[model samples]
Each structure stands twice: as structure tokens, then as C-alpha cells.
Target: MKLLTLPSFLLLFFETAILSNFVTADTNVHYLDNNEFFKFSNPRQIYGTKPLHIFCYQGKPKYIIHIWQSVILYINHSTDDYNQFDGGSPEHVEKEYLEKRYSWTSGLFSSKSKTFHLNPFNTSCIGIESQDTYSVHLKIIRVDLWNILKLVAGIVFFLSAPTLSKNTLFHYVCGVSSGVCASFLILIYFLSKLFPRKTFMYGVIGAGWTLVIYFLQILWDNMKTILSLYRTYVIWYIVITGTISFILCYRWGPVQNQRTMNLIKWSLQLLGLLLIFFSSHFQEAAMAQVILLLLFTYVPKRWVLAPKMYWKKRFPPKLKPISNDEYYEQGVRETAKALDDLRKYCSSPECNQWKTALKLKDVKRFASFIEGNSHLSDEEILEYETSIREEVTDDSDNGEDAQFSEDESS
Candidate 1:
């Protein structure tokens, strides 16, 4: 079973690799929402005689739609009533509903791009209804890469989760999630700056900053312990808790003895720290080191050498033998009192017959018997009592039969 672990992980890794490629290829399908742009290209013989329609649904509050073509063409925009022309062609749309929308005549001979801020709440489609007999290509560019990357990253992350330890996986997920969120917020912040008209961007930015500050404050609160643990385990304080460093050094280093291995590992760790300190992302590396050390120290171990060695060296303390006589006596008294209460409460003729059937004269012996059979369940005790009652009934019947025989003989 243990030998199959590596092979299983390798199989999973290959499967993930193949699936990632499959997903990337599959993203190019003709779903408007999946793509960054919706494209229209005229065929070789076909000119711009037929109208081209681009449908939009579930539109946002604002969409910066950029429409560019290979040749000059007249483009018509729909009003806010997007659903009015649901699945309707441009020719079928009423002329009265056609509003004076965005137009670019500057590049009459060459292809020019026209931008529009469209709200697709009611508008169904953007149409190019020009009757011009020229080959034309149109492209509508929107936000695509970031959204696609997020989806792909999420899929890969989820698939890879089973291969990682809980702590490592948690850190990875938190880091990726926070990094993606921060990147999105930064994008939004810049977008808000560029488009001062979007007032809600400011509120979103403020909320994002507030959450970031709150988390930073929490990190600050635990900064002391974090730093202490890192310094003690990951750096110079290697005599006790540098399990990772010790293992790596002992396994690969040329040193054979414990003292020499410790010295070599400490030196190597110091060198690593120095290199990290000089790097461009010193702060990130430092924090990551701290987190790594924290994880290493807190992770549950199956066998710890230090604890085992300490226990071995320490002498076992002498303990006096404790007697359970007091407890036994207390239990006997309680049982006797309970039986007496039961006997007094059950004063009916049937109860008296049952008591006589039991034939228990010594209450102490009965209590001892009960204590000895205390492990038996309630059902077992009831069954035992029933059997005793049956035996008493049989004995009484036999005595009556013997008395009748004696009377008959007399």
C-alpha cells in the first residue's frame, strides 16, 4: 500500500496536466460570456449586404463596448429596453425605435473604432444594417483575460487540493484568494480613477481597504509570537526545534555526527537567510519563512525524539497503593438502602410473593451478588429475576402436589 503512494500521485498529476490543456482549449467556444470579444467576418463572395447582429443579455450597469470594423459601416444601437427586440433581427426592428446612437465618420475610407457605454437592461442586440457591398470584419472587445484566468486558476486549485497537506493547502488557498482579490480591487481602483463618473467604485475601494487594514491589525497583534517562533526555529535558535533543517542537513550533508550536522545546518540556514534578506522580496520571504516555521512547529508528529529521550532519562516516581475499601463499603451501603426502599414501596401481595420467592435473607449477600453482576444490563437482570420467579412457581406447584399425595395416602 505504501509503495503505491508515489505512483498514484504521479497518475493524478498527469491527469491534471491533461485536463488543464483540455479546459484551455474548451474556453474558445461561442459563448458570448466566455469570450472577451464577439466577432463577425464576411465570407469571400458575401459582402455587407446581409445585416450582422450581436445579441447582449444580462447586461451590467456599464459596459465599455468597443466596435471596430475592417470597412466603414453604419452601426445601430438599441435603447435601454433590451427585451423589446428579444431575438429580433435588425431588419425586423422598427425604424421608430432606432435611436441616434454612437457614430464615427472621421475615418470614412479606413476602418474606425466606435465606443459606446451600453446598458443592456432592455436592449437585445447591436446591429449593422448597412447595405454597402464590401467585405467587412467586426470585433467587440470586452474584459476577458482576467475572468478566464480566474476560472482556470480556480479549477486547477480545486483539483490540486488532495495532493497538499491541510496547512500548506490552507496557506496556498488564502494567499491565492487574497492576491486575486487584491489584484481585482487594484484594477477597480484604477478604473474608478480613470472614470470619475462611477461613484460606487470609491465605496468598493473603501470597503476593500477597510478589510485589508483589519487583517493587517490582526497580523500585527500576533507579530511578536510570529517573529519569536521564526527566529527560534528557522534561524539561530536551532538547538531544540529546527526539525526541518536538521532532517535536510542530516540526510544530504557530508557530516555524520550530530554536533557536526547541527553546525552545518545552522550555517546553511544563516546563509539562506542572508540571501533572502538581500533579495528584492525580502519582506515576503521573511513572512513566508515565519509561516513555514509556525507550520513546522505546530504540526502533529507521530514520534518526537526529544520527548521520548526526556521520558527515558527521567526516573519513574514511587506511588503508594490506594485501597478501594471505602468505595466498596459506600457502594454496599447505598445498594442496601436502595433495596430496602424498594421492599418498603412494593408492599402489595404480589410484591410479598415475589420477596418470598427470592428467598434472600441476608441483605449483604444480595447486595454483594448485585455488585458482582453490576456489569450485566437491565434486560439481563430482568430475565434473571423472571427465571427465579418461574423456578419458585414450579417449586410451589411441586409442594402442593406432594401435599395432595400425602393426603390421599393418609
Candidate 2:
């Protein structure tokens, strides 16, 4: 894309404003008691609970995890009379009744957490009112399990699924996943600057970032009323995380060139950081940004020395096996023995590794399997290349062909 034009700048300027007002104006203003800057006061005086036993932020996409947690605390701590809006004196705001956002114009979000549309994670609960004598309990589970789940799934599916990672598919998976992982850490550093969710970045991204993104359905499936205290926690987590994925996929994930690849990653991530404040203000518009972002995701971008770039990015001398000869020697021998058992189970020792490890049969059979997949991946890659080679006019993606190359190189 080119530099922003005058018209483009003006358009985005107003877009950002409208977006900001929409997000901030119609949401809850009092969720936390972070002095007066926050929307709500502490739960100590408001309810009978011993403050919320909230899990401090653990980083990842839910940057404002702490802020959302505080809201849960206040809600869970209130008694029946806390905010009996309709009953008795309609002066008190029930603990269960919370403003959805921090906007001044928007009144409190009366819909229970479980009822919010975006809150597909069946988490929100019916706001229960306990007496001052009853104590409140708010528990926060889930410790970056989503990220781990994704990594495991990707590794297994890519390794097993036929035609999925043939050409350079394997390598591309490695490369893109590596880049994604790196970008996630980078995202934490940059995002923390704006929303400073209290959590250790290292632990959040350690080895579980991908799994957290994967198991989101679990949250969606479990809609327990007691989960009300943690409703904001789950909802905010899904929206921000999903939005980040949407934004990154459209921007950095599609590019080529190591320098450009990293550049695209960092630039978009930072821009998202700046825009996220706007998200809290205008949730809908903030979400729309991703849809607006799709305009660029499929549009092709050019590259120089594309092959060289792919090789260098995907397969450096350091990463290659010390000697393909010795490595494949044993593999070939084992594979050959298994060739004899062709129709039947090839229990040969050599082919045993592939058979057991990959769940393939004899060595020759596994090789055939790999070759079959390679053919399919190759065909797909060729098609991708054909689409992208010609001036990139309404063609396929740049990275689509990279999968084929990954297969060849592997």
C-alpha cells in the first residue's frame, strides 16, 4: 500500500473518532476502583466478599485481563440489595448489574454476562445477591492452555494430513508458526505499553500461547451462572484475541521477505496497539477495522529473488541435517525391507520408525505416502504459482506456493 493520501487520512481520522465515541460512550464507566480514573469503586465497602481472589493477568491477547477481573470482583462481592434497581428503593445498583463498557453516554449494561451476544463462551452468570453476612467467591481458571492446544494441533495435523504440508508446506508451517510465535511476544511488549495488563510476559507466551487461542470453544461451551464473576474475563479475552488474529492474518501473515515479514508483523501489531484504545471506546468499529483490513489481505504484493528468499528463510545450512546420506541410508534400508511386505503389514525394523511414529506402514509404503502427498502439494503449489506469477492480478496468495517449496526442501 502507498502512503496515506489527504482524503484517506481525513477518512480514517473521522473513522477513528466515530469509532472511539461508539465504543467509549455506551459502556460501563464503573468497573474498577483504580482511584477515580477507573469506572467503579472497590468491593470491600460495596459487598461482603473478601475482595476477589482474581488471578493476576497472565498476558497474551487479553491485555486488560486485570481490568476485567476487577469488574468481576465488584459484581461477585455485592449483596441482593446492592443494586436492587427495580425492587425496594431503586437507588442502589445491583452487583450483578454492570455497565458493559467505560463510556459515559452508555448506561449500565443490564444484560447478564452470560447473555451478551459476543460472549459465546457460556461464562456469564445470573447476578446473585448475597447478604452482607455471606461472603463472595470469584475464581479465575485457564492458564494459557489455548496456545498450547493450537501448537499441538498444528504440529499433528500438518504432520499427518495428506496434501496439507507437501511442497514447502512443512517448512511454511514451521516458518509462519515461528514468526507467529515471535510476533506474539513482540505483541505483548508493544500492547503492554498501552493497556498494561499486570502480568509476566515471559510466562504468558512461554509455550502455551497457541493453545489458549485454540480452547476458546471450551469457554463458550461452559455457561455456568457462578461464572458471572469471570464473565468479563472470558468475553474480553475472546474478542481481543480473535481481533488480534484477524488483524495479524490480514496484515503481516500474508507478506514475504524476512525483513518485510518482520516489518509487516511489527508495524501492524503496533498500529493495532494504537487502535485498541479505540476498541475499548467503540467495540463495533474496532471490530470493523479487521473487516476493513481484509481489503489488503488477498491483494498480491511483489518480491525479488523469491526462490532465494524462500530458501534462506526456510532452510539455512544450520537447520539442515548434517548429512542426508547417513540419515536417509537407514531410512532407505528399512523402507526397502518393508517394500517386501507391500500388501501386508511391513513390520521391518527400518520402516518401523515411520510406521510407528507417523502411523504409516513399511518404509516404501510411507515413502509412497509422502510422495503421494508431495504430488498433491506440488500440484497445489503450481496452481498457486500460476496465479501469482502473472503481475498478481486477482490471483492467489504469495505464501500459498511457499508450502510446495517447503515440501520439496524437506
Candidate 3:
């Protein structure tokens, strides 16, 4: 009497697990809910600077360093809780940036600020409030040059790959997103060092822009369901797809000279759009999650980072399963061409009589265009030859009427 849905439920659970982030206690130095750290200051204090940290992106959950897309350590000015200077209410200032409700794009009060609280008395208001401009002394931490360079280099290498595929737009989008984030991080790094305050402001701009884009994606995804405008979405999808196509086909995909990659890029985009159109609950948040999952799961496999997953794991990365361009470059296309020819020739009158070569195995082997012997023993070849003879003889007898007319007419 047990139901059949049990296995499907288990599958969904595992799917979620693969997408979840692994967090360490050390990474989460501080854990503050909305009211605890980011609330308004007690009306008792007057003036002082406390360290304030406003984060736009958390690279991974539960990490000690608390890597962010952008971090601005503000020096808050306060009185009652002197250990930390609460940097006025930041919510007013973050109106343009704090859009991703599902994520902490606006960050939290020091979940670990208490541990790192340098100012004994002024610590309370360090990251609170937004009035005291000097109360918030912001510091932008630069991503490791190596990490930044690695992302940049990896993206370049991926693009440089003799095989660029067109089926997986998510992979390309991830590469593009990583490259952009890294480039901006680098720019902010140099700018923060040289220009200081202005650079931090610009960093805020970049961080806001990043969140904005993420939000837009979410909005689009959610709006389809929440807004109930499938027709408009279809229109939007077409416009965007068409525009992206023109850009990729005319400008980047071909000009860069990788047609396979171009095709993959376009195909994925179109498929993603179709998925967006059909799926009722599809949200930007969900799509972003899927993109991230695909990035972690699919891209590495394409790079041959490991062997393929099996049916046991459904929804496994199917991004251009094998890089068509690279395979073609590796002479897969030529082999295919030869096999096609063999298939045709085997069906012809000259070879159809012997019919040995007409078998799929023989044709495929011959089409492989490999020069050396297959190492098959004479016994093995004889066995295969016998099978082919029997099949061909039967086929010839059955089709005699069909072939007889052609021969008689000739």
C-alpha cells in the first residue's frame, strides 16, 4: 500500500542539498537579527566613531572571513553604549540596494562584532543608524589578487577553449558574471587604495548594481507568476532572446570565432526562456538558484573536471554533454562523416551483396576512419561476419522485389 512518491521526494531533497552552502562557525563571526544590530540608536549617546560593516554579498554561508561583494566598515558616533559607535540608521541610505529579500544583500549587524568589538564602550552604535556621516568609516577589503586573477584567467581560458558550446547559457552566464564581479572587485581594489572614500562610494555603486541585477532577475521570475502576464513575458522573452542573439551571433560568438559556443549560448538562453514561460512558480530567485546550481554542477563537468553522473542522479548536468566543437576539432566530425558515407555505401548495390560492411558496427568502425586493425581476432571477425551474412541474406530475400525492378529497368 506504500505510495510511489517516496523516491521522488528523496530526489528533491538531494537536489536541494547539492545547492546548499556549507558554512563554518569561524566564518560567521557575528550573528545579528534585524533588531539586534541594525536598529536605531538609544537616544543617550552624542558623538564618537564605531566600526560599521555593511555587506552587499556573502560569498558563501558560514565562513569566518565573511567575504562580501562589498564591505564598508563605518565609524559610528554614539554615547550610551560607548564601546561601539552606532553608525546611524543605514536602512534610509540603503533604499536603492536592499532589494533581494531572500538574501542578505544589505548584510547584518556584526554577528561577530561582539567578538571583534575593539571599542569597549562605543561598540553599540558602530554599525547602527545613518545620521553621523563620520560615524561610519568604511573600509573595502580587496579579494585576493590570486582569486581575482584566477577567475579572470579561468574565464579567459574557458573562452579560449577550442570548444565553446551553445547549449548551456547558464555556464556562459556564470562565466560572464564571475568575470564581471572579479573585474569590478579589481577596479574597486585599486580605487579603494588610491582614492579611498570616493572608491568606497563607487564600490557601493557597484555592489548596488550587482544586487539590482540579481533583483531584476528575481522580479522577472516572480513577476511571471505573481503578475500573471504570460503573454507579456513571452513578448519580453522574445525581445531579450532576439537582442541577445544578435549580440552573440554578430558580435561575440562568431567574431570570437567559436560557433559551437555561440550555438550553446543561444540554445540555453532560448530554453531558459521557454522554461521561464511555462513553469508557473518560476521566480527570479529560483532561476538564480538554478543558475548557481548549474554553475557548480554543470560547468566543471564540461571542463572534464570529472566523469559523468548517471541516471541514479536525475537532472544531472546536461550542458552540451560533450563539447561538440572540441570533439569536432578532435576529428569527431570527420569520423562521423565517414560513418555516414559508409552507411550510405553499405545500402548501395555494390556493397549490399556482401552486406558484411552494412552492419552498424562495421560501418561505424570504418566510419571511425582509423587506419589500424581493431585487434579483433580472426575468430571474432568470423563471428561478426556470420551474423552480418545471415541478416543480409534475409534482408536481400525479403527486398528482392524492390531491388529487382531497378535492376531490370537498368
lDDT of 2 by residue, 1-410 (tens): 34658789888997798666544322221211222121233435543432211111112233333212212222333333332121111112222133322236333433222111111121222223223433323334333343334334433432343333232434344455554434455665665566445555445555356544443344444457427778887566556665555565556444345665445444444454344323232334435544544333434444435777798889876765548688779887887666545524433444554436465334554555434333234777888888766746534555667777899999
Tens digits of lDDT, candidate 1, 265-361: 4544444444333221224443454455435545666445668767767965576764689777888799878866665545444455456547856
Candidate 2 structure lDDT:
0.41
The per-prediction CA RMSD against the true structure, in angstroms, equals: 29.7, 29.5, 26.5
Stretches of model 1 off by over 4 angstroms after superposition: 1-50, 53-101, 104-172, 177-390, 393-410
lDDT of each: 0.44, 0.41, 0.43
RMSD of 2: 29.5
User: By summed lDDT, which 10 consecutive residues of candidate 3 come out lowest?
Assistant: 21-30
Candidate 3's TM-score: 0.19
